[model samples]
Target: MDDTGRTPVVDLRLDRAHSARIYDYLLGGRTHFAADREAAGRILAAFPAAGAAARINRDFMARATRRLAHDGMVQFLDIGTGIPTSPNLHEVAQRIRPGARVVYTDNDPIVLTHAAALLRGRPEGRTAYVEADVTRPESVLGAPRLLATLDLTRPVALSLNALLHFIGDDGADRGHAVVEHLKGALAPGSTLTITHATADFTPAAMAEVGAVYARAGTPFRLRTEAEFRRLFDGWEFIGPGVTLSHRWCPDRPGDALRATSAEAACYAAVARKP
Candidate 1:
């Protein structure tokens, strides 16, 4: 702990392969280490469209954020925020609503190192970063920075893109329970947007990809369409409910048609609390 008595940030552990770093590597970011690159290589060999899948997932995030911001939602809570890439959540939200406030949470130390990029926002808006794990919803929900930046009583958009798959079911409803806990905390009209990896389209390829992640010490559980839909159980879906990542409000006219569900390998949805 520093003189402030708060816990110090953990080590980067560049030798270890973290799911976030591997995702960074797949997204063509330079923040990953050799370990992350190696794991991404294996995943690519198993599923050649892994990079495209990552891009599709990212596009889903931008679209969802824009839709929420345009719809007058001014606060955002993004958990499992990976390494900072251009057009971060704040950028997309603030573009539509300059007063939009965003709180990004992630356990990865590398994301903390690059937190500054996530914090640059318009003078009228606010952006904060909280280094916390999604598995411990209380840690994120109760964070001082989060509490200061976002008003829980107000409508906030929560995005969990490409994250829950890492939290494996374990036959105990692990990921689902986390979502439920977070959902219960938000006020009515708050939105929950998620993009999760699934094996429903190509079970063999996704299984091989999961094996690669497991070998890298990351637990990856690819859910089915039914299981993915269960994450947003009681929430009201916004548009094109629980479709393929690229198919969820594609920007271009034929963009969704160009990418097959097997190529995307992920499902995307945005729902609001009743």
Candidate 2:
């Protein structure tokens, strides 16, 4: 609560590597520490294109946010929001619709420490942060801050970019179930956007990368295209359907062509609740 008037729960946990920090490191963010860099190095050894995958996934988030905002969606609920990356979901959405409302939730305390950056949105819009885990969707959806910033009755654009893969199947298809529960809660006409890691293109390399995250005490489950598609079950796809992260509504001429499927290693899509 230093100067931002927000008290951050400071459990730094610099001793072990965190998936969020590793992703921040890969995305060339400075919020990571030494342990994060070491784990990122091991992941890079297994999958050299990890950095590219991270960037491509982030670009997909930006594109999805812009599309949703441009299409007249005003409320955004971004669960598993990572470290404050520039042009964040709120920034992208607010830029398109200044009155857009965004609520970001993440489990990491570091992200809470930097949550101030996420809250800095257009004056016409509203932004809020909730330090909560995605596994417990109830906690996130019922958070006071989230409720205050977003109207549950409105069509909210829910973004789960590069997040679901961390939730292992656990023999019950828990990840998909959680997503379904969340989707059920949103209003009709709401949108669900996701970008998840997949081993379809480079199984061997991705397996090694999964092993690294496993060793780091993180559950890394790379799903297939069919499994990825199931997450959006009962919803209608926006356009182009499910595709590689880089190929999902590319904004620039060479954006989609810049990364191969193996290099991107993630599947992305946007769908409406209808």
Candidate 3:
């Protein structure tokens, strides 16, 4: 690791656009570079509510983490953790359960640079960052930091928020296969939380949005409601079944009213392994 805590061999790759950085740009974060900004602008043009959708997805993660922590879950494994946004998963989980142990995994090296921010949590809580890709479940599940911080035998809260869309279905790295691999590693009672982009609401706009990402060298597959729900097959839903991102376990009355389905453009749910 370098002085910045980033892996020496991991290239920042600022010339090309990365999905995580593009997401950071959409969330109005400063960690994004010019390539990410350019792709985000095109995405906004394709879907005017892109920024709102990103924010709604982020809120769902916080709600899911809080719900899991309140339900007596102390170990968390959050894959595809993007740039360190304030009130991150560890912050929300630790607030509810101060001793919550969180393992954050991401493929982006830029995220590795910002891992320090992700590591800072309440003294009683434990936070670790694993630089790995979700496509190879073993890389994340078997990470040293992850194994040291979380007990896979215990009930864990696994979150994959606004991430699966970047993984296409036709690749050898199939999205469902990867998810199933991770799910199979967890013990029963482990909770899975997901917020995935979908075309169930605005098909044409989402298709255009996908095209924008494709042009930027990123794969974006917007699943339908049925397809998204299938990702949680066999898991018992915690609250309302798969719903719009903003509609899932809304903390405030206005939270559900905050965004329309088309604006949120994402499906969210929390389910437990049965």
Stretches off by above 4 angstroms in model 1 are: 1-9
TM-score of each predicted structure versus truth:
0.96, 0.96, 0.95
Worst 10 residues of 2 by lDDT: 1-10
Q: Give candidate 1's TM-score.
A: 0.96
lDDT of 1 by residue, 119-171 (tens): 89999999999988888899899988899899999888999989998986667
What candidate 2 gets wrong by more than 4 Å, as runs, is 1-8
Candidate 2 local lDDT, residue 147: 83
Per-residue CA lDDT of model 3 for 118-182, tens digit only, reads 99989999999888889889988887778889999989899999889888767554888888998
- Candidate 3: how many backbone clashes? 0
Q: After best superposition, candidate 1 residue 232: deviation in angstroms?
A: 1.3
RMSD of each: 1.7, 2.0, 2.0
Q: Write the per-residue lDDT of candidate 2 for residues 16-104, one digit (tens) a residue.
A: 89988999999999988888899899989989999988998888898888888999999999999999999898889988899999999
